[model samples]
Target: MRCETIREALSARIDGELEPIAPGALDRHMATCAECRSWYRRASSLHRTLAAQPEPPVPDLAADILRHLPPDAPLSSAS
Candidate 1:
């Protein structure tokens, strides 16, 4: 398989998406392709580090946004 195809499959594998490449084929390709192996290592490390962090709180901006709207403005302009 082409390196591009393998790299894409590696991304899907990392993201927990459906596995497209056969497991044996992927392992064999990675074993021989140093560049792909390096890329996968970095990408996997980033994925793990990001996944371990707690989600940041989402700010509630609805009230603040509504306050900025003009009083007479129509909510919807549909005829």
Candidate 2:
């Protein structure tokens, strides 16, 4: 399997999405490919670190956005 294909599969697996390639296939490829093994480890570690962080609070902007909007005009009657 190509390294690109294996890398894509690795990312999908990390994201909990269904992997297109068989798990065994990926394992075999990574076993022989040192670069892929290193990439997978770094990607997995980054994913775990990011996932563990708490999301910052998002301020409600609806009211502020609506306040700057122009008022609606009545539609003219059509013949």
Best by TM-score: 2
What is the lDDT, from 0 to 100, of the residue 23 in candidate 1? 79
What is the C-alpha lDDT profile of model 2 across 18-47, one tens digit per residue? 999999999999989999999999999999
Q: Candidate 1: worst 10 consecutive residues by lDDT?
A: 18-27
How well does each candidate superpose onto the true structure, as a TM-score?
0.68, 0.74
Q: Which residue pairs show backbone clashes in model 1? A: none
What digit string (tens of lDDT, one per residue) describes model 1 on residues 28-78?
999999999999999999999999999999999989988999999777889
RMSD of each: 4.0, 5.8
In model 2, the runs with Cα more than 4 Å from the true position are 62-79
